[model samples]
Target chain A: MQKIELEISFFGAFRKYERTGPLRLTLAAGAGMAAVKAAIAEALDPAASDLLKVSALADAQQVLSSAHVFDTSAQLVLLPPVSGG
Target chain B: MSQSPDTRSIHVCVRETHLSLEKASAFVDAGENGAALLFVGRVRNHNLNKPVSGVSYDAFAPLAETVMGEICVEAQAQFGPDLRLYIEHFKGYLPIGGISVIIAVGSPHRAPAYEASRYLIEELKKRVPVWKKEHYLSGDSEWLDGTSLVENP
Candidate 1:
């Protein structure tokens, strides 16, 4: 497996941990969404883990499940549970 | 998601500007659909005994829009195909008493319009990729996560 660069976008309080914005992570090229998400959770401070795990990923169209496969796309979105009324 | 963005009889958006009730009502307004149900979400002054300064809304734009559009579609399907739906949410900082969200539905009858309007707001709260940060008067800002802060259970 080759290492590839992926950028993860965050919202809500997760933004505080990712102040640099769109955190850049290097992971196996063929990693699936769940794997990358695991890595992200492990990389973050404990306080941010639940904030990330309870979230979903997004590309340009819609929110993706953890089953999606990663590719060369540099940008990904982390959407935490919403509370809009 | 629909193949073409323009195909749906609904509107979805996530923006930094204030939401507009008139715009939402106009979009779905039709002569045949006399029932226009509008729900406006505004920022209140206090939460849990703390004076709320305001709120900042952040969203996964593409995903938020997609989910909102899908919600509108589902409401239409459940209510009636002729149901016209308009939904929007505001990003950026909204001061206390500011309008943050607008859900407008025009239907052939009042019952469907009322039911669909309620469904749109409830589902939007649960499913949309939007987050609200409450900036309290105590100089602390807190993320309103999930249904955790729902009052009265």
Candidate 2:
């Protein structure tokens, strides 16, 4: 199994949930997006996975949906829809 | 307030207690416009058949400003050289009949100014992160989902 570094941002109501560092998880190279999200949930809180509407980005652009697969060196960020005015 | 020749447009805030037509007009003049269209959105005393007293608004400032800037960029792209626009929205408590939002657009002609002004206000109401807390005269208050109310969420 290889390790992947993920950067996560929590906004709006979720900001109150985790004020500190992003959850870092190590997964196999061929892991699916769902599996990676589940790993993050396990590291954070199980309820977080349910509350979060996640969007993954490759590089600084291009929004990736859940159907995409993850590679070992891929950079990922998890952000929930910010509920604001 | 000072003027800059390089800045043909401006955005400013007026206290709820004191709104000035002069300052707002200056922004339009600064843009060297032949026509200016301004939209003032006020708080009504009643809403949806219910009595209303006041309202409060809150926002994530950085994100809100970024979003507003994006709107301006989009307006520029859509309207091209014919339009210059300014938008101002009040946060915190606003009493009945108080102006809550202001949008001003300037153009060489009234058509683009009017069209852009309408577009700016509609898009801002749809996209901006300024949430309102509606207060009723019956002693109840509720936080309104701004985007949701505009059918953009």
Best by the DockQ measure: 1
Clashing pairs in 2: A85-B129
Error of 1 at B106 (Å): 0.6
Please give me the DockQ of candidate 2 compared with the native complex: 0.11
Error in Å for residue B133 of model 2:
0.9
What would the TM-scores of all predictions be? 0.89, 0.61
Steric clashes per prediction: 0, 1
Model 2 chain A scores worst on lDDT over the 10 consecutive residues at A53-62
Off by over 4 Å in 1: B1-8, B147-153
Question: Over the stretch B65-127, how does candidate 2's per-residue lDDT look in tens digits?
Answer: 555656666676677554666776776687888777777877887788877777777777665
Which regions of candidate 2 are displaced past 4 Å?
A: A1-85, B1-20, B30-32, B148-153
lDDT by residue for model 1 (B67-113), tens: 78888878877899899888889988999899999999899899999
Task: Report iRMS (Å) of candidate 1.
Answer: 5.5
i-RMSD of all predictions = 5.5, 6.7
Q: Chain A TM-score for each candidate, in the given order?
A: 0.84, 0.66
